[model samples]
Target: MNSMDVVRVLARYRFSYTNEISLQDQIEAVFKYNQIPYKREHRLSDSDIVDFYIDGVAIEIKIKGHPVAVYQQCVRYGSHDSVKEVLLVSAKNFALPDVIGSKPAYVYFLSAL
Candidate 1:
């Protein structure tokens, strides 16, 4: 799947209203359910580790706090050479940022559905 398609698939996933599955696990489960291939922490260096890199996109799940920090995190991840897009998946909606430097960026609200 492509970047946008992966976003769509992940956007459709509704986490069970329970404590068993974590946000991170839910994300991975959704990706697996859709049969989309991904690599965790496709490292840029020793410290910069994006949560999930799929189809030339960086998907960072931010379930709490303000969107600005998450958006900035997306920007940082988008700067990587292999990343063509960045998906900032959050619990609340926020204004999407324009293309950061060169890579296209998108925001997907996980709770929108």
Candidate 2:
């Protein structure tokens, strides 16, 4: 499948359970399915604590609500050269507030970024 198709397939995996599966876990599963080489967080610096670190890319996933603290954490953790990219994965209707600056980023809905 193409990249878009792959993203769509990944989007469908999002579902709410009593015990919710984390966004990093879901993204890791997708990466595994696609045979994408990745390494989870193996370091514990102040700026290294996040959901997942795939191929040195720091990804912070959020659900529907806009948590200011979480967004700030992602920005701070992602502000390093070791981090290739900082991505915010969210549900279809997730709205971010204006406090966060316009940085290099991507948003994925039920479709590709």
Candidate 3:
């Protein structure tokens, strides 16, 4: 599925815990329940790792952080050859732009639903 499709699927996911690890686990469960193919904790390089990678989308989960740092990280992930888009699942709404670099960027806040 595309990044937006993946986001829609994840948007329906319900979470009882808000911790980063728990959120990751719930996300993995959602992907499995929907039969979505993905790689958890995908390593892009020695220092750069994404929370989940599906098709050409790289998803990152953050419970708390400076918005700028998170966006930069997602942009770095987008720079990777395998990633065509970036998705951030964050606890707080960062109001990120529609695109980061040449690839599309999306964010879903856990606090919303």
RMSD, one per candidate, in order: 2.6, 5.3, 1.4
Q: Pick by lDDT: which candidate is best?
A: 3
User: Where does candidate 3 stray beyond 4 Å?
Assistant: none
Tens-digit lDDT track of model 1 for 1-113: 55678777865667643332377788887778777788876785576788888878887766675767766777778778888888776666765666875988877766633
Minimum summed lDDT over a 10-residue window in model 2 is located at 95-104
After superposition, the stretches of candidate 2 with alpha carbons farther than 4 Å from their true spots are 1-23, 42-44, 64-66, 92-103, 110-113
Full-model lDDT, candidate 1: 0.72
Q: Write the per-residue lDDT of candidate 3 for residues 49-96, one digit (tens) a residue.
A: 999999988999998889789878888898888888898888888766
The candidates, ranked best first by lDDT, are 3, 1, 2
List per-prediction Cα lDDT, in the order shown. Answer: 0.72, 0.54, 0.86
Better of 2 and 3 by lDDT: 3
lDDT of 2 by residue, 37-113 (tens): 66665353764665656655555556554566666666675566666555556654444442233334444553322
Ranking by TM-score: 3, 1, 2
Q: What is the RMSD of candidate 3? A: 1.4
How many steric overlaps are in each model, in order? Answer: 0, 0, 0
